[model samples]
Target: MKRIQSGTLRALSNKEEYFETTDLQRSIRQGYASLLSGEIEMPTPFDMGALIGPILNEGTESEFRAELTRRIRRFIHNRHPPLNVDVETVERHLIRRLLRTRKGQTTLSGIGVESSGSSQDWLQGIAPWRAVRDAQKEHSSVLASLGDNTRADIPKNILSHSMASVCGTLSLVPSADISELRSALGPVRTVSERHTQRIVKYLHEHTDWVHKHKSLLGREAPRSILRQRYRAVGMTLLAIWPLKEAIRKWMEDNPTTHLRYAMGQIVRSGQYPSAINDTLARISLIGSGTDGRSAPAGPSGLVTWWQHSA
Candidate 1:
């Protein structure tokens, strides 16, 4: 029989006592729920293969415990984004499992497995499993909302559930589709109906503009430029929604070849002359011309001008 050292015996006793405490018990419950629900990831177990050398050599109990702790800590640090569990919580579970196996009270089968049951059994009940089921239900609901292109059925705090997990699920969506945009923007809980409607209208207008001036803008006009232009217009409209009808009427009456130029003309002629300059400044397009000149008199300049003028 392998004789247990006094230090190892005492540490094991203390650990067993600690596990019985309410605080540790509650933490274990919460941690297990989080892990099983995929809110916090379970790290891969440390490679115990290396411990064979020292164990065969009859290393001291304290030395073995120290080595195990060191290896587990190293394993956690090497994780791609690092383990999210509390260090104390992880250490407690790891040390307890190690103690159980060393005393022959448990048997090791593989990573996260033991003869007594799986390492997950340490969580003590079915609560964690139920938490996982709830998480799956929530995830399915969010996916359904994305598929339907509507936020009416989505949970209010769904975005706050787990950003990384939510984003990973959304990554499966095709970027070219409107569903992708809806999914990305649906998480913005503060977005209002007026803002959404205005954004939809702006997108329609921009699409029409693109189709009309495909030759002028060039077929290869960078998608980034188009996105920036859209954002600029959207932000301007947000600031000037009360005046949107007037702006729309003005745009229809005096149609220029390009959207930006028309905006600049409006700014130059509108009651709020300084607004054009302000919007341009806000969007970092003010004075963006060769030789340190103010914005040019073309599409780019006009877009900036309109943003401020509106």
Candidate 2:
């Protein structure tokens, strides 16, 4: 019989620790076996880092932990029969292990280490982005309903410009004329007169939140809190318009990929979904230079630009 260290056996016997370790070990073993069998090539540690580092670096701590749990659960599901383990249990253990690691410790310490607090408590202490995200979530249903009603009425090109405007990629000066907003649609030939009107109308209606908070817009603290929330409808329009077709095609071809899963969540939201965390994770895994395969040509530039600007 192989000798097992007492600490190792104890770790394995603990249900939460057992599942995480078993799942990871199984994934590593399966990967190696596949490589040896010429079924798949091995990814270098650096490659793995490239696939995960960006998300860890850029995502909120809550997001990072959630994504980590998701990945582990997904990996286990893909490679084996369902484990008789509770999802919450596995996640709790994985989060603890992650926080105890050097990288996790550094990340937590940066936010001011609390001797005792939950991850949510830690997140609450750090950024206002969470508040922005919550506000967006609260409005997602209304935005979704609006899109369902108005999407068919608006032309695609106009929709794209409207979305970009919402993203703040296209400048919308408060003093700008509505005609100026139409002209910002760029040199697209043959824009329908009614469609143009719809775009203008949509922009005005959705951006009313910005005006409501107009006084706060100039102050950094207040503006930052509400900007993303304010842009929620535009973000939804962008996802539903120019990006939808591309995301649909990707999801069809790579149905089980994490990128596909994340994109699916965003698409389903039909509003400015809280997708930055998932998007970062997807980009880390498959975007240009990470996996040596470029993201799907459509919307890749927009996604790249959004990440940089956001």
Candidate 3:
């Protein structure tokens, strides 16, 4: 106002620029104020690596990507404001990161992924003995339901010997290869890396059981039958390996005990009906050795062993 400063005319001529600068300065000051008052919250950087590491360690690449998307969605959903993250975008990022790592590259290479370095740590947790037991269970299930013209059909004697070999090997070494048991002694005796690890775990846990029974259980023919059928044969034998006492008492108590009668006695022993019936069916298949009938006498060694043990 009073002839405003000498160069004021020029400044007024650039009025638009001056006003823009003023607005910018005002915005900066307000931004600082908002920050101090906690109104303009800063975004935290999400750790995509931690989220992706374990997911990559899971089964397949497809599984990893699927899990990644689900997890990212869940993480965003769990946020207070429910972050506006694109799940597919995060999945693509995580997968790209995995593809960059050496371990991830090798794992997704489609060659022995089950035994990859990344998966070995996970596999190490499985018991080798449990693997052997599972394989044995699968074999038993097949044997129990043998059919005509089945390529898996092995002679009863050979099957029995193989079962014994498995028991002896496991009992003595606990980690010996019984891969032959799976293929019925075929040329191909392949075991997956995952199963190999499970066998390793089994050996670790049942080392004591194997050492104690290797000598006694290994030579016993009847024990092979039990091992072939029951998954818990080791524990079962531990409870009642020498059935001399129980057999003697039972013989004295019931001179003319029949398999059917034994089944009846088992049913009346206060156990669950379904359980007892299932057990009786399994036992009757083994048959008792005493009865002169063509069919097995009730309560054979298979029956008596578990009876005393149970």
Candidate 4:
């Protein structure tokens, strides 16, 4: 059995947006399979790191994203306080945010709920740009700029803790699960991680609690305490600088044509079939990469759904 320890594990996301997607060269998460080898057999280790190194080093969008997926997973699963986020809850939040935007569209807050990271990758694949548009708004900056009063009733520790957990949870999802992740990103279908990343980065920027209210009136100690809570998980005030700028820009442009262009770029990346299949073949449609997972299994544990569907 391949162990996670045997390979490099990087869990990362855009700053506080930790663990949006996790892709491992090691296929441990796929399922456990033991080979009945009379003699001990060791499968030669190919450099999965080699597969992702350039992507990491150069940050070509796809390679960078694949690498980002790896780091986020690491951050999520390895944090000190442990993230308790359920992917389902994230999906629910996406839904509520999408639902709320309609009522608040008149106000600047109309664009609060949106997708980020590879979360929107799949949607971008199926229908490209037109499938899901303006489904979620970038509210992180608003959350950050107004961090003082936005969730004032809630403890900074809770807010930071929640975002950290979310970022970490994102790390757990796999690349092939992009579609599953997109479908899970709320009511909107067909999106990409790049889409999710932008939205989330905006959220981190707008809702920067540490940089904003870490020293609010008479709460220096409490602020420190809250900041420390997030720091313990490897998140820091300086991590999301770019995200903040994006939010500021979004704020200036009412219609936010720039933001739309950025989101469109995400959809644009999957213009090739390889990228599309590479993302989709990861889930629902299996049997492509490692262990070419057998056809779907039946209730009786023998018949596969693929047998009928195929």
* Lowest summed lDDT window (length 10), candidate 4: 233-242
Q: Rank the candidates by lDDT, best first.
A: 2, 1, 3, 4
Q: Model 1 reaches what TM-score against the true structure? A: 0.21
Q: What C-alpha RMSD separates each model from the true structure?
A: 26.5, 24.2, 24.8, 21.2
TM-scores, all models, native as reference: 0.21, 0.26, 0.21, 0.19
Q: Which parts of model 2 have CA positions greater than 4 angstroms off?
A: 1-140, 143-162, 165-175, 188-193, 206-245, 251-310
Worst 10 residues of 2 by lDDT: 220-229
Tens-place lDDT per residue, model 1, 1-310, is: 1223212222344343211344545666799588667687666663212222222213555666677777775654343322344432332343334334434543334632213322222212322112223333454454454544344433332122222222222221111222333334332112333443333333334232111111245453211112221222222332232233345456457545433344455655666544443434322321221223344353346444333321
Top candidate on TM-score is: 2
Error of 1 at 278 (Å): 1.7
Separately for all candidates shown, the number of backbone clashes (residues 3 or more apart, or on different chains) is 7, 0, 12, 46
What ranges in model 3 sit over 4 Å off? 1-178, 181-196, 200-232, 235-271, 287-310
Give residue 80's lDDT in candidate 1 (0 to 100).
30
**What's the CA error at residue 204 for candidate 1, in Å?**
13
**Residue 139 of model 1: what lDDT?**
45
Model 4 ranges with Cα > 4 A deviation? 1-43, 46-138, 145-273, 279-310
- lDDT to native, each model: 0.34, 0.36, 0.33, 0.30
Q: What tens-digit string does per-residue lDDT give for candidate 2 at 1-310? A: 1223222333233233322345555776698678666687556653332122223423344565677888765654343322354433343343233334412432124432122222122122212222223433443443566666675664333233333343322121222233543343332212334654554455446533432122334543211111323333332332233343444355456646544144444444555343343333333322222122343333344344233212
Per-residue lDDT over 1-310 for candidate 4, one digit per residue giving the tens place of the 0 to 100 score = 1333445433445332222223542254342222223143435442111222222333434566677888766644343231344433343355445434423433223433122222222222221111112212323324445545444532232123334333322322221132343443332122345554433443344443222112235534211111211221211111111122332334355444533343223324443333222223222231211132342222221112111211
- Shift in Å, residue 176, candidate 1: 15
Assess candidate 4 and give its lDDT. Answer: 0.30
